[model samples]
Target chain A: MFIADCQARLAFDLLAHTWNPVLLWTLRHGPARPADLRRRVGGISPKVLTETLRRLEHHGLVTHRRYREAPPRVEYELTALGRTLLPAIEALGDWAHTHGDDVLAAQDRAR
Target chain B: MFIADCQARLAFDLLAHTWNPVLLWTLRHGPARPADLRRRVGGISPKVLTETLRRLEHHGLVTHRRYREAPPRVEYELTALGRTLLPAIEALGDWAHTHGDDVLAAQDRAR
Candidate 1:
């Protein structure tokens, strides 16, 4: 049997990083060059974006592809396994949309 | 309409904390005292567990209750809204189960 704590903790660790889900969600549509990703995901620095992409690629969630040319074109896309996480991410988004206000309010009170 | 980027980012923020989901998942069964939580979620310090519980309560995901006994008793339980997060968290867990090895392997390669 899958250990609930270990399995669940694994998922938590995966989703716990700020940029991981955002990058994954950003690529939900399809592959894109770094320039396009930077444009699409505003507020992220190029350096940070590069690091996040590398992590994602390292995790097998995204692939790094290079197109040969004078100025080599490179792009990133979510792998099939990575695609499976879209729905899971969406479920989280749905929860946030429905109840994020309460959380914000609570945070406000705490502060 | 919920902006996909903003909505998705909100979810990421909520789930991005290492202990948030773990604490939330720990209370899946029912209410528990801090001692029980610390026991169930091994490796977490009492201080950190308390902090996590406070955050979850602040987020309106968990409720704090106190008993009117001699020493006084305090316990935590998931609210109705908090329970909603179970499936979402589970969805993430499912993804981890299927592909977490790939992520681990990739991390090892990067190391």
Candidate 2:
């Protein structure tokens, strides 16, 4: 077990935020405009999405590109550093896919 | 990316709590009495540790055994279901070990 201040806790802190991994996974497909991201990701408010993206960007997990088109299109994409986290996220996703029912059942038994 | 209500979100929810993963990891070594847990875990208030343990018990990730000898003792250990999450947690830990400095650098740059 890692100590409370171990560097590994940093990964937990990154994943602890409700939306960070979600947005990171969403951006894995390719660069996406904010509106497109909102649509694809679903249920997240524009404000929260923006905040999440800014947080990801601040951590250098993601980067944004502004296309100076007629209306100034902007898009977000994962950085190489950001791409490194995909396997970890996918591992958790795979676990959930297989055992989510078990967890739900456990929860049900508890209630 | 997974939809907001996807099963994968369950894993994220499990990990989102700051101390859940920490406690889970601690229990991975073996069963320990609550007091031993408090001493080894360090800095966690007794109340929060109890709450986190109960939450893990409720989720079927952990089980407790009570011994009625001497002063009476209870030991907590991870369930089979709980053990399944170790690899996923380890994956994140490994990632952090490798890339935590990068994240710190990014945060520093953002500042």
Q: For candidate 1, lDDT tens digit of each residue in B1-111?
A: 123357567667778887888778789999999988887777888888888888788777899889999899999999887898888888887888787777777678768
Error of 1 at B64 (Å): 0.8
Look at candidate 1 and give me any clashing residue pairs: none
lDDT, model 1, position A42: 78
Model 2 segments beyond 4 Å from truth? none
Taking the tens digit of each residue's C-alpha lDDT, what string does model 2 give over B16-104?
88788888888888999999888877778999999999999988999999999999999999999999999999999899999999999
**TM-score for all predictions?**
0.90, 0.96
* Per-residue lDDT of candidate 2, residues A20-64 (tens digit): 998888888899999988888778999999999999999899999
Give a tens-digit lDDT track for model 1, residues A69-94. Answer: 97999989998877878888888888
Error of 2 at B41 (Å): 2.3
Where's the lowest-lDDT run of ten residues in candidate 1 chain B?
B1-10
Per-model DockQ? 0.57, 0.84
Residue A102 alpha-carbon offset, candidate 1, angstroms: 2.7
